[model samples]
Target: MMNWRSAPLAPATASQTASSEHADERIKLSDEQVAAAQIKLAPVETTQLAEHFLATGTIVPDADRIGRVAVRVLGTVTELRKRVGDPVEKDAVVAVLESRELSEVKSEFLAARLTNDLQQTLAARYKMLWESRSYPENEYLKSRLTAQDARIRLDSARQKLLALGLNEAEIEELPNLPIEELRKQSLRSPIKGRIAERRVDLGALVGREGQESELFVIVNLDTVWIDLAISPTDLSKVAENASINVTAGPDGPNGVAKIIFVSPLIDKDTRSAKVTASLDNAESKWRPGMFVTAEIPVPGRGAVLAVPKAAVQTIEGAPTLFVREGQEFVARKVQLGHEDDNQQEIVAGVNAGEVIAVSNTFTLKAELGKSEAEH
Candidate 1:
């Protein structure tokens, strides 16, 4: 709340006298009084005034930030490291499974590795003997070819292990692990996020026919999407990369979201285009399924003469603005045009580069009313 102080109307200036037609509507006050009344002034300028339409939307997790934790091999859930709502990091192991299918692959890799090692040793010895003429050239050649074949098999087996989700470090450690642990494999998250859903329990059989393939679903809520349905009439006004203001509800999270997607096809039943906006939610104040309202801005005519919405006051039911002329302020009736939340287009009665009272125009209106009463 602001305290309003009344000031005596000063003598009219030459410009005010020139505009004698509006002399009665002018209110005068000293610089000290203007400062005390908290009346701020700004230059009227040319800017775009966009029209807006409201659309209902819902908050949801960003699809690109979602992660699924699953395994490729047939396995039994032996351990669950995370539950619903637990935070997880990228590549973090969230669970472990025991799979005979995985054990068979590991065994093949180990056998190929051992055979390649033995063949390489034998090939090297045959080379040395051949160099000294102690071994036959044909025998040395046979040994060398066998080693080459063994190397190719070893590479193939290693690739199979990689396809089954074993990392380089895990495959290297396979030969050192005891035989009993050969069947164990870990499930890791592909993204840093929180566990949104846990579909498996300990001892549950997964990765089989008619069984759940995903063990957990993780979502990063640092950013979220507000899905909106735009009517066909306003779809032309909306475009990708534009911004919309969104409010979850009364007393709920509110933010300006960037339009990321605008569907080309409209729904047959609703006749509305699906639009989506990306909003930063680092605070995590918003959640999925929360209903929100979005204010989409319709493209406006290029730059036009405009003033701040605050500068326009309703005097006796008509929109008015106080233009600062010389040392006094004069109430000028103006014609209004397209307007958005902050700016109102002035189709008439105002010109660019003229300084006018912008904030606290109500005080000037009060002073004008008082002057009228005095007259």
Candidate 2:
């Protein structure tokens, strides 16, 4: 009877005892046993330590290098010679305008030239008379002054025409041409570049008072820009003239870039500093507003002691890792630096070529937690 009914087992007490025993068994391994278990742990691959900085950016045209072509006078666009994306040379004719003002300017220049010729003949005659003592010095001087005034008027008229894109020789020859042909003015491209924009179509009246319309926009696509917005915290890591890598497509056709400028002011809303990098676009494959990824290499303090990021663990906000000594893994604290998405830099508490648990760190952590609970 004593053996069969030994304090009729309580189901709750029995269950509790079983759980405690299981927990005790989990932490029952001696130090020597733990050392043996750790020997079975796999070694993590070692990597050379280096500094890395992450940033996102986009491709844009260098605005300072862009050029614009606009109509100089109010006129109807008689001809639209260039379309968007057409390559143009310096001083090439991009469009033609027919304007009444241009015709008037040509006429004024012709009349001034004729008056100047007549005055020149009179002044020459006065000079001969004065030299021969047939005219007073003052009279000859006055005549000469009148002739000089007329010549000045002619020069002013010629310059006005030239300011309107008319050559001086062209203005002098305009009166010989038909009136209908003289009225048309050709607008030329000022720079060698491709047409990036076209605002006016054929027959569009541009250059009206108070109307600042842009007839065309030209961009020199031989060089491009990489606009990177870097956080203020990382601004110190960048340097002007530093080299960077630029990837164009999704998979990336990689190219090299040089840091051109870094803005001193931070964006009010985003608090990020703007950095610009220049790239050669000689092939014209990169276009404005194209999305791109840029990688800027930040110099590190040469080689340093480090470990794989996965090997590091956080125990109550303290960064820790398992140091495999002999057959045992003891938890050790470490100071970290420059942690990228893949790997972390260990400034202290570890050395190169040392084996650490990387893949199954969570399992080790769980084992530690269970041991603590049992205690």
Candidate 3:
């Protein structure tokens, strides 16, 4: 560390010497001394300083990212492939159900398929005989019509299987499955997530009237929502798409998030409006129901003279900043107006285009304290 000492200056005039003895707020440091002391300077410029409002919120899973595995047909849960908190992929089979209703549909499809094949064979034979004049045209027409009706029935059966949650591939492969497995249907997750809730146990009957049809609740924690409660007084400062910083306890920073929603109506009991923000949780660091603090930037009044946060120092209970006047640095008491995380608005005691010490102002404060002690 470089040692900090007051730099010497040339002799002052009579009035200057008398003024220096009166207040003695100035500390003179040479160019090399300033550089060695690591003192940096910045111009007091006009900037839009956004004041922030504090609000509390809880982390929750994004509503759109949550998925549910539910059954449509009456069935008994035969197997569960995933338990609560288990990770799952999109379209992953999470559970299996055995249902007599599904078996009947599968059987109907098989019957229709067999009849269609038989009718098609007979229709081909009848067409050959009709072309050879061995069979009447009317008989051949009836045979072809029967083949068409069989095809229609097969299509209807296929549709029924689809409505019962069978995909095209599954329905196409139905004939190859054994008889015992015919009643079994696999339930797949609609999204890639972790299972949040499991509502059914093995052998539990689902899809019955007045019974729970849902099997598992899966949530994608890649992104989450922070529901904030904004009071009525600070509601005007909040706007959609505004950015904010979120922190969960003392576990470092959770990064920035954008405001996605703000409610127009305030809650009567809480006397606050609801605001929502979306935070990226791809690391799985944040979870639902975790309490977090959010810092929201309030709208700035306009551009005003401002200085870096480091430039301001507290001396004798007054906010002080060191302003460069010619070759000397003078401490001036400043009246602060509004401030954000980076800047503090200088409402008085400073002007635009004025140079001030922006870094290591505490060194200047120490020197000022030392000078007063000498007197």
What are the lDDT scores of the predictions, listed in order?
A: 0.89, 0.74, 0.88
- Candidate 1, run of 10 with poorest lDDT: 1-10
Q: What is the TM-score (0 to 1) of candidate 1?
A: 0.77
> Per-residue alpha-carbon lDDT of model 1 for 1-375, expressed as tens digits?
222345554546447567667555777666776777778989999987777999999999999999998778888998999999999999999999999999999999999999999999999999999999999999999999999999999999999999988889999999999999999998889999999999988998888552878889999999999889998998999989998889978899898899999999999998898999999999988899999999998887799999989999999898999998766888899999888889999999988999899999987887777766656
Give the residue spans of candidate 2 off by over 4 A.
Answer: 1-50, 167-176, 209-212, 299-346, 349-375
Candidate 1 lDDT score relative to the true structure: 0.89
Stretches of candidate 1 exceeding 4 Å from the true structure: 1-43, 48-54, 131-134, 236-245, 295-301, 313-333, 353-375
Check candidate 2 and list the clashing pairs: 35-327
Instruction: For model 1, give the RMSD to the true fold.
Output: 4.8
**Best candidate, TM-score:** 3
What TM-score does prediction 2 earn? 0.67
Each model's TM-score, in the order given?
0.77, 0.67, 0.80
Tens-digit per-residue lDDT, 1-375, candidate 3: 333455433222345445554456777666667787788988899998878978999999999999988888998888999999999999899999999998999999999999999999999999999999999999999999999999999999999998888889898898898999899999999999999999988888888552679889999999999999999999999999999989987865577999999999999999999999999998988878999999899876889889999999999999999988776788889999878889998889988898999999998888788777766
Q: Sorted on TM-score, highest at the top, how do the candidates line up?
A: 3, 1, 2
Please state every model's RMSD to the true fold in angstroms. 4.8, 11.0, 4.1
Instruction: Report, for all candidates in order, the number of backbone clashes.
Output: 0, 1, 0
